[model samples]
Target: MQASLFSGLPDRRERSTAHKYLAFVYCTNKEWARCDAAFDAAFDARPSFALEEYELQNTPWRDAYVKAQGKRGWQCSRPLAGQGSNNRPGQDSANPLVFSLNSTIITAITPLLPAAGGHSMALDGGSPGAFGARRPMRTENNVQLRVSPWANVTLNGKRLGVTPPLTEIKLPPGSHTIDFSNPGFETVRKTLKVEPEQSITITHDFDAR
Candidate 1:
């Protein structure tokens, strides 16, 4: 699909889009080199691609993007104090130059109805909010799950066939809920609104006490 898109599209903008999409695909596959190549192709066609249009916050591939750009000295300017860094996952909080965010990470309080228990679960975190109230522009609905080594993951209250340490799942775009549970760690539940062709990644860090 990526090769077809790149080969078929010769226009600069279209090619740029293809490269960005390919970067996203490669990121999901954990192929950093191919992802970097895609980013290079994307920026060659559109120099301002990252600064003006690419989304860095809550994106699963930002770490790869940052490392790729760092090799080329494409340092991203930080957004500023209390401006928008809370939501960007891969940015360094102490080093402003490596961090940025276009909007706040939206969190809402909601009750989680248990699948089989009489008790209800209280969920307190949410996905990143719309960018500037106009909805961040997106293309696909990919869900990437970064679970702890021993955590079990469930989507929309349904347990996946796998047990733990899951990576990614592609789903239809819409509202989805995720839960991460382990014996010794606190179960985490979150609600996210997914957009078309947009990849959403949720990482469950089990180190917190």
Candidate 2:
């Protein structure tokens, strides 16, 4: 992942700075695991990094960051707009906004993580509901299939196999191109984005010639 390179820098300050932005990306996408990991990494890399300084330099981004982090149970160090400052005695008014802003910065960089492998794609649950839960089971990830009656499936320009009605294929998380066709049916081509541990299912109906 291009972002992983940011983790390799020898400068703790540089790494922490990059992590702040990356955390924001991950949090925005609701990838809590990755977001939390990035946040922890940032703090661990620079225990004394000044949150106030970070917020002062990146105010608006910080606000959004805080709001995002709040969703994940992190408290903002400063108060919201119109609220009085909460800084400790002798310390800077612990503008709660500082924490809030940093929180958001953590979530903003999740999608950039590299896909699982060359053959995988990312998938999401889409919407919440009973039906949403059913989708994953119905769709398999990265499996080859023949579309019932008589059709062949080609993935990444390579002839794979055929798929049955409502068949699910197991694939790695990332992006992929699928081509479906049969002798008389119109060929359908599609690009799919799959996420890790997510399943994908497709149904095809052929017309008689």
Candidate 3:
């Protein structure tokens, strides 16, 4: 669809519109590299592309891309207090500070969410069911969970959302038992210890009865 649009444009005006549209589509789809490339190409073709216009159209995307890149140390600036340096009141500088990428990203992006909070949690591993020795970490405030529709989700004792693909939800820090249920499938239960500046993932599969 995108390729078709890109190829269909004939005039400079049409081409410029196509580029902007493609950039927006990429951004909406969370294709950061493609979005940046599209915008870059547009600007290259039309140097007159206004920064304000670009920003208005791409600020959310740019912020997300910058943050995603920052996690991998792609384009991060040094903090005034310095990396892993804590300035807690009366705290000794000798104390070690742990630098958590998940915590930093969440803290940086949460403010961008609507009044309900725009924060979303990410599974560390590509596959949710793949579990390692380390358990998933939950954020202190407004923790978000994304799960597959095939996977059931329940908070406390009450059933929360449906299985397969689950909607994102905001949760406070503490202990929460998530029950995954599927008909003709074995139930999976996970106990999560939630804290601020932490991200965790839990994955399981149910067998058909």
In order of appearance, the predictions have TM-scores of 0.36, 0.31, 0.31
Residue 170 Cα positional deviation in candidate 3, in Å, after optimal superposition: 2.6
Cα lDDT of model 1 by residue, 1-209, tens digit: 34444655657776676576556545544466777788887777767666332255434356666666676666766442343332133535442222232222211111111122222222223523541122332422255455433345567877652212134455655787777765434677878666564555455445433
Please identify model 1 stretches exceeding 4 Å from their true place.
51-54, 78-209
TM-score of 3: 0.31
lDDT of 3 by residue, 38-68 (tens): 6665554554443232233213344433333
lDDT of 2 by residue, 4-121 (tens): 6666778999777666655554543445556566666676677644345334232223444444455556576654555333222243532222222122112211011111111222
Stretches > 4 Å off in candidate 3? 1-149, 207-209
* Window of ten residues with lowest summed lDDT in model 3: 108-117
Instruction: In model 3, state the lDDT of residue 82.
Output: 22
Local lDDT at 200 for model 3: 55
Shift of residue 133 alpha carbon in model 1, Å: 33
- Model 1, TM vs. native: 0.36
Residue 141 error, candidate 3, Å: 8.5
The positional error of residue 161 in candidate 1, measured at the CA in angstroms, is: 28
